[model samples]
Target chain A: MGQYIHLIFPLVIGWGFAFAVIALSHFLGPKKNLKTDLTPYECGVEVVDLPSSKNRFDIRFYLVAILFLVFDLEVIFLFPFAYIFKSVATVSPFLMIEMGVFIAILLVGLFYVWKKDVLIW
Target chain B: MFGWIYIALCSLLVMFAILMVSARRPISSAVFLVLTLIGIGVLYLMMNAPLVATLQWLVYAGAIMVLFVFVVMLFQLRELNPTSISTHPGRFALLLLLGGGFLGLCLKGVIVGLQEQPVIMMGQTLVTGEASLKDFSLLLFSKHVFAFELLSVVLLATLVGAILLARRKQRVS
Candidate 1:
């Protein structure tokens, strides 16, 4: 409905170009096999650990992720509020208090999480 | 042309949703669900609601799904055994009932909203630069202020509850 065609236009072009290059290489490029060539990239350094499913991530990883999500959600909600703040403020100063209440609650959550030592390794 | 994209997005959403439910692997299910979320965002974009779409992308698809992946990794959960999942008929029945109830509620809301479109249009006409957003904020703060305040309380409870749940309980000597 809108002129959002520009948004996807570059995306379509990029994908088409990528696939074209990949296909061209597959057809025309040499398929020689070498041990060094097949080796996994190591950032020009020695590879540390080969990735496998046997290693389990620490629980703290998930905990940190959850905390990140909670605060991330708080930020996202603030976007709409911030977007219309000036106009809303002009209408009624009470509008600011509404957002203040929301932020205060999240700040409480942050304090709770902090006191609980959830952020510690 | 836009209609075709909308159809494609809807089909993608439904397909990924099905994949999310039916996939045996936890990782695959999370991935499929993320795809479904992206499809929903794209649909929102097509509908010219960039704010909602961006919010969906940032919060739901990005943050929430990142957390889900971490959860899946924490569990190190691989393929779900079909026999183990499907064997519990009672749980299955309960799930079916709950899903049906939720679906019915959604359908009812959609029908009611359609019938009340004219009333909603009064608020709809204010679509402009930031006036639409300001209008929404005013409506939310003025009309739904109580509910908004309640939401903060709910978040506070959830925060406390989550911390309590996550904390290691001390053992009695």
Candidate 2:
């Protein structure tokens, strides 16, 4: 618990700096209420679809995100095994088999995705 | 005191969660959800599970939030107008009751835990709740090995399901 006390300094300083910057700009900066100023600047181009809803993106972006999430969770689960692999292996040789099985399962998923051409796009 | 810090983090988490659900814009809601996840990660750190906290931030706040934002952008949802929200008093009351009951159960568990005496091991009180990375690894790889392996299978299913659902259907021969 005490070890984490030092982390408080960075958090405090970071948030303080952010709030200070925003506060300073709000209080000191020029306040022009022009309609042009309120609009989003897009290299002086006319804004289109700024307020319109239901813009559809390519489905592939969502697929990539899903793939990333699956692999990310797999990595997180591997962390504990990697941390204690040696110690646990000394107790029994089955630890290796256990991790192998885990990876094998995920590998099948990866193989399935590869075969399905999900990663091509 | 740690208790004060814990309470502050819990309240902050609750505030962010409320903001997440109530925010009009999908992007704002996603951002608030990230803040709520970060607050939970900090709470995990305070509880002496640094590894869990790091994973919480990495998996939930980082990867999951990325997915959330991507989905939001994919849908390209605009702000929800307040007038468009239909109110149902019965549904609201039911939700309130469910939330309150869950909160009460959690508070009761906390109260019971605080009332319990600390375990004395060899005449020295053991730090009961401290879960360093080494301790976490020992438990995960030994007694919980079955559950750990099962988690991988779940991930595999999720991966295949996600890919199958997201990918365009193949043309039939």
Candidate 3:
């Protein structure tokens, strides 16, 4: 419990500070009311919907997110590898093969995404 | 005193976080959030938990927050209206009071703990330094092996789920 609290304390402090600052800003900042300001801005164009449109976003957005996640997880695995590379190299040549397989999977996914034109803007 | 330094760092992080939340552009907010995360990571380092600091960068900043920013950019949500946020004076006051009480309790607890231990500032021991990487890897494989496997499984699931979610359904025209 003590260790947990020590680990969590900084996060709590950060969140608390963030909330307080935002709340303070609300109280202290100048008040302005205008329809234009309230309305959602779409690439500098006026929003067609009065409230807001609930349009489904293109799948490419999700594709990009998934690609990012794939790369991020790859990096996570790489960190430990970096730390223990020398020891692992001495112990097992198989480690390189395993990593190669992992990279191959990621490469396949990337190729699939590319073929689907998900990378295009 | 270290207290003054802590306070200064905390203030800087708070200011950055506020700027992040209030920034009109999502990309700008995302960038500010990165700074805030790094600031928090530095706090972790100051607390003498390099492992936790690395995890903070790897998990929260590197993965989760980037995903958040990617979604924000993709969706292109309009800037939040500052004024439209309903303000309740009494509720805000109560929340502030509660927050203060929580902080007071935390401070008291920390002081007591420090007094008991005399807060021995551990130097870079073999276990906590670059030299310990081999031991760390051994510990991960032996003791934390289950966690390592579970993380892999989670990543695999995430990949499959993401691909499924992104797959476009063909319409029978």
Docking class of 2: medium
**1 versus 2: better TM-score goes to:** 2
User: What TM-score goes with each of the models?
Assistant: 0.70, 0.74, 0.54
Clash tally, candidates in order: 0, 0, 0
Best-fitting candidate, scored by TM-score? 2
- Better candidate by DockQ, 1 or 2: 2
DockQ, candidate 2, comes to 0.55
Extract clashing residue pairs from model 1.
none
For model 2, residues B1-173, the per-residue Cα lDDT tens digits are 34544664565577567657766688998999999898888888776677778899999999999999988878877777653322434545554554565466557656764666744212231343333567877878778988888888888889878876876877323
Once model 1 is optimally superposed onto the true structure by TM-score, how far is the C-alpha of residue A73 displaced, in angstroms? 1.9
Residue A98 lDDT (model 2)? 86
lDDT, candidate 1, at B107: 61
lDDT of 3 by residue, A1-121 (tens): 1242376688899999999999999999898887778877787787666444454567666667677877787677667666776777688775566556566666666666666555666
DockQ scores for all predicted structures: 0.37, 0.55, 0.19
Question: By DockQ thresholds, what CAPRI class is model 1?
Answer: acceptable
**CA lDDT, every model vs. true structure:** 0.71, 0.76, 0.65
